[model samples]
Target: MNTPHTAAPVARLAAATAAIAHQKRWFARMREEVAAGAPLALVNADAPQEILRAMGIPYVVNQWWASVVSAKRMGPAALDSVAARGYPDDSLQYDAIGLGSMDLPAADVPWGGLPRPDFVIAECGADATRKVFDLWAEHPGTEFFPFERSSATTAPDNWWEIVPREWERAYAEDRLDLMTSENWQLVDFLTERTGRSFDIDRLAEVMALVNEQAEWNRRTRDLLAATRPTPVSVNDSIPAVMIPQWHRGSVWGRDAARALFQEVEQAVRDSRAVCPGERVRLMWIGRGLWFDLGLYQRFQEKYGAVFVWSMYLAIAADGYARYGDDPMRALAARFTGFTDQLYTPPLSSQWYVKEARSHGVDAVVHLVADDVPGSAFTTEALEIAGIPVLEINADNADSRGGAAAALEAAIGDFLERRVLG
Candidate 1:
C-alpha cells in the first residue's frame, strides 16, 4: 500500500516520475492512497481523471458505472458497494450513488473485494449528472461538495439555439483552470529540479483539435445517416463507445470517426443493411438513453430504419476536425469555455440540423429540453428537409420525470403520422 513514488512528500521528484513509465506503478500509488482511507469521487465520463490524480485522491469513473446502474434500473445498488454512504435521492442517480459511496463507512454495493470510495464528486452539466452531484452533497460526513464548473461555459444564454457572441464572456467561470493552475504550481514547485515551464500548450492543442475532429465527426454522421450509405446500430456504435470518446477530442476522436466512416463506406459497398434507392434514414437527436437504452429500439428494428447519427458524436466529428496542425487556437475557438445553459446560439440547432441534412438523414428525433434555447430547432430543421420529424421530451436518463411516457407517445405518434404534420 506504500506508493514510495508519490509518497516521498517533496524530495523524490526525479525517482517518482522515472517510475511512472508503467501504468501499473501509478495504479499501485492510487491504491495505496485508497487503502489508507481516502474516499473516491466519481463525476462525468469526460471528466479529466488527471484532476483527481494531481490532487492525490482515489475515485471511480461514473459514466460506465452510471450506464451500468441505469441499464439495470438499480441505480442505488451500484454505489452501495463503493461508498455505502447514503445520499440525497431527489437528485441525479450519479450523485445518489456517489453520495452513497461516500457515506458508506465501508464498501457495501457489490464489486466484491474492490476498494470502496470515500467521497463523491457529481455534476449537473446535464440531468443525470445534476442528480449525481446533488445526492452526494446532502449527506453529512461524506466529502461531497458542489462541483463549481464541470463544463467550460455556464451562462445559460450560450446553451441555446443562438449562442450570442457577446455571451462568450461567460467562459470565465470554468474552475478547471484553478486545478490546472494548481497542477502547474506543483510543476513549478519541481521546476527547479526538473527545469521546465510546465508547458500547457499540449493541453491547449488538445482543445484546438476539437474543431477538425468535429468536422470529421459530422461527415461520418452524415454518411451513416444517408439513405443507403452506412447502416450502424444505435446499440452497437452510438451507445456503448463513441459517446465517451466524443468529449476527449482529437487524435483518438478523429481516428474513431475515421474508422467509423470507413466502416460505413464498407457497409454501403456490401449493400447489406442499407436498401438500394432506399426509404428512411433518420437522425436520433436528443440526450441518449441512460435508464433504458430501448428508447429507439422499436423504430430501429421494426421499421428497417437506419439511424446513422446522434448529436454529440456528430458534433465532435464535425466541430473538431478543423485544426490542421495547430490546435490550441482551435480549442480556444471551440470550447474556450462552455456550460450547459443550452438555450443560446451554441445550442446551434440550425448548424446541427443543416449538418444532419448534409449527411442525408431523412428525419430527426429531437428530444426537446424545455430549458435549451434552440432545442426546438432540431425538429424544425429536420422537417424542413422534407424528412419526417418528431419532437419528443424524454429525459435521457430520468425516465420517471417524463421520458417513459413521452417515449411511448412519441414512438406511437411517429409511427402513426409518419411525419410530424
Candidate 2:
C-alpha cells in the first residue's frame, strides 16, 4: 500500500481562503440589507442571478445554502423538519433543505441562518422543484417566481464549441425564446415589486463580466488538466470555483476567477501536488457530497488516488461562456439547456467522455442522485471509453443514508479491484 508523503500540511490556497472570507462578509451585508427593508431573493442554481445583480437586489442561492446546511451537519435535522411538515424529505432534499433550514432555531442554523427572502425564483425543471419553491412561497413576505423549463429536442454533439459563439444553432430557438420571455417576466416582476428598474445595458455589462470569468476558468481548468500529479484538489477547487460562481456577473466574481487561475498557475509552476504519489486520477460526477468532502481525499494515503476532476470546475469551464450582441437572449441561451448539457442523454454522456479523456482520468466515482437524469448513460459512456466507474446512489446533501462509511468502503473496494488492477 502507498503511504502519503510526509510533507508539511498542505496550505489551503489563498484564493480559496479569501473567497470564503469574502462570502462571510457578503452574507453579513446581505443580512443587514434585508433587515433595512431591501428585498432579498433566494434563487435556484440555474436561475439567472445576473438579473438580480443588475437590478441591485440582494440574493442568496438556494443550493449553496443547502450545501452549507449539509456541511454544517444540520442536514438530517433539516430533513426531519421537512418530514414533520408532511412533505417527502427524501425527495428533492437538495432543493428543499433551505426551506427546512428556515424552520430551524436561529442557534442551530448555519451562518446565523438565511434570512427569509422576499422573492424566491427557480426554473420548474424537475418534478418536485416547483413544489419545493411553493412551500418557500408559503412563508410570510415571500413570493415565488417560476421559469418555464423546456425540454431539449435537439442538442448537437459539439455543444461546447457551438454554445460559446453559435448558441442560436446549439439550442432550439423555441426553448431559447421561452426562457428569454420568462427572464423578461422576472425582470418585470422584480421591477414592479421593488420599484427597481431593469437596465438591459447593465445586464449586458454583467453578462460580459460573466463571460470573462468563464474564460479565466477555462484557462485554469486546462492548466490543471495538463499538470501531472494534480496541483489542486477538487475539494479546494470546488469552493474556489463555485462560491465565485454564485456571485457570477459581478466585478468581484470576475476578479475572484482570475485570482484562482493565477493561484493554480503558481501552484503548477511551483510543482505543488495534492498527492505527491498520485497514481490514479479520479473524476467525481454529480452534486458534491457536502456532508463528507473528506471522502474526496480519503483514498490518497492507501491507494495513491486523488479526485482531480469535478463537474463544478469542469462545467464552469465548458458550460458557461456565451458571447452575443443581444445580452438577454445570450443569457437565456446560457441557461436554457444548461442542466440538459450536464444531465441529459447523449449530451451528458458525450461530454463526460470528452472530459475524462482530456483529464486523463483513470476512474470515476459518479454520485448518482435520485433527482438527476441520465446518470446511467454517463457512467456507461465512461466505462465504454475504457474507464472504470463506481456509482454511489445517495443524496449529496442528506446524510440520513449513513453514506460516509459505506461510501468509503465501496470506494476502497473499487480502487483495489477495478482501478488499481
Candidate 3:
C-alpha cells in the first residue's frame, strides 16, 4: 500500500515522472519511424543535445537510463549482464549499467529497454567512457562518436558565482575553442551520417529555449533555498528538476521548468511542509539515492530531520547557464569541464560550502564514490566552514556494497552524535 507521501510524489515531480513515461511511450512509437530509417542517438549527458534537438534526431541519455535501471532494482542483474560479457561489473557501474542491461530479456528490461542507437555519442570523460561506447558500437547497428574532454587547467575558487555570467573568463579560451570546434565536427558528422543539414538558426532557437529553461530552474532553486520549512522534498525535486533537465531545449521542457517553479512557489505560499515539524535540515552531496528514496523521509517523523537539498536540483540551477552571441560557442562553454566544477577540488569544495551556508543546512551526508574526483576536499571544506558532514564510502548506484540497514544506522548515529548533539 502506497501512502500519500510515498505514492504521490509532489505535483511537479509527478508531472516530470509522467513526462518520462510519455517520452518512453513516444520512443516506442518512434521505433516504427526508426525502422523506416530514422536516426536515433544514444547520448551521454555531457554531450551537446541542442544540436540533436535542432536536427530532429531523438536521443536517449545514458546516465538517465542508468538511473532508471537502478531505481527499478535491476542494478544487480544489469551488472551481471556486464560480468557475463567478461567486463568488470564493479568498474564504472553508474555509466556502464545501461550498456550492461541492454542484453536483458525484453520483459526484464526497464521502460521496454532502450532502442538500438544508430549513433553512440559521448565525451572521453574517463579512460573507460569511450571504450564502453565502443563496445556498444560492436553491435551491428551502432556507431560511436566521441568529443575530447580537456584536462582541468583552470581552478576557480567560487565557480557558482562566476559560471552563470562570466563563464568565458572562468574557463580558458583554448578549452572553449576545442569544445566549439568539436561540436561543429559533431554537427558535420551527424549531417553526413543522417543526411540532415545542420541549421544555425534552429540551433539558436534551441539555445534560447535552454537558457529560458535554466533561468526558470535558477528561480526555482532560489525559491526553495529561501523558503522556510522547505516547501518540497528533495525526493520530489529530483525528478521534477532532472526530467526537464534531460529534455532541455524542448518547449515541453521549458514549460515543465516554469511549472516546477510556480508549483514550488505556491507550496511556499501554502506553508506546506513535507515534514511539518521539521527541525534539522540536511544537504545531500552526491548522486540520487535510487535504491532507497524512503531514506530521505525516514528521519523526518522520528527526529524532525528532513533532507532539504541535493546536487541534482542545485547543479541544475548553477551548472546549465551560458550566455553569448554564437550559440555553439555558448553551448561549448556550458559543457567544457562541466563535471569538473561539480567534482574537482577547489571548485567543488567551494560550491558545496557556499550552498550549505546559503541553504541553512545543519549537516551534510556526503556519499563519496571512489570514481568521484574530490570527495575528501568537499567534506573537509564543509567541516572547516563549521558544518557537520558525515562521509559514507559507497557507490550511489549499487546499494549492495553497503546494506541499507547499516547505512541508515550510520546516518542515525551521525545525526544523534554530530548534528543534534
User: What Cα-based lDDT does every candidate model obtain?
Assistant: 0.46, 0.90, 0.84
lDDT tens readout by residue for model 2, 1-421: 1223432335688888888889999999889988899999999999999999999999999999999999999999999999999999988899989999988999999888899899999999887999999988887789999998899999698688889999999999899999999999999999999999988999999999999999999999898888777888888899999999999999999999999999988877666778888889999999999999999998988988999899998899998899999999999998999999999988889999989988889999999888888998998899899999999998999887678999899999999999887
- Predicted structure 1: lDDT: 0.46
- TM-score of predicted structure 2: 0.97
Off by over 4 Å in 1: 1-41, 45-64, 76-219, 225-229, 239-258, 274-278, 300-302, 320-343, 369-374, 380-388, 399-406, 418-421
- Candidate 1 on 151-170: residue-level lDDT in tens? 44444332322322232343
Q: Report the Cα lDDT for candidate 3.
A: 0.84
| Better model by lDDT: candidate 1 vs candidate 3 | 3
TM-score, structure 1 vs. true: 0.61
- Give residue 97's error in model 3 in angstroms: 0.8
TM-score of each: 0.61, 0.97, 0.94
Candidate 3 lands at a TM-score of 0.94
Residue ranges of candidate 3 with Cα displaced over 4 Å: 1-21
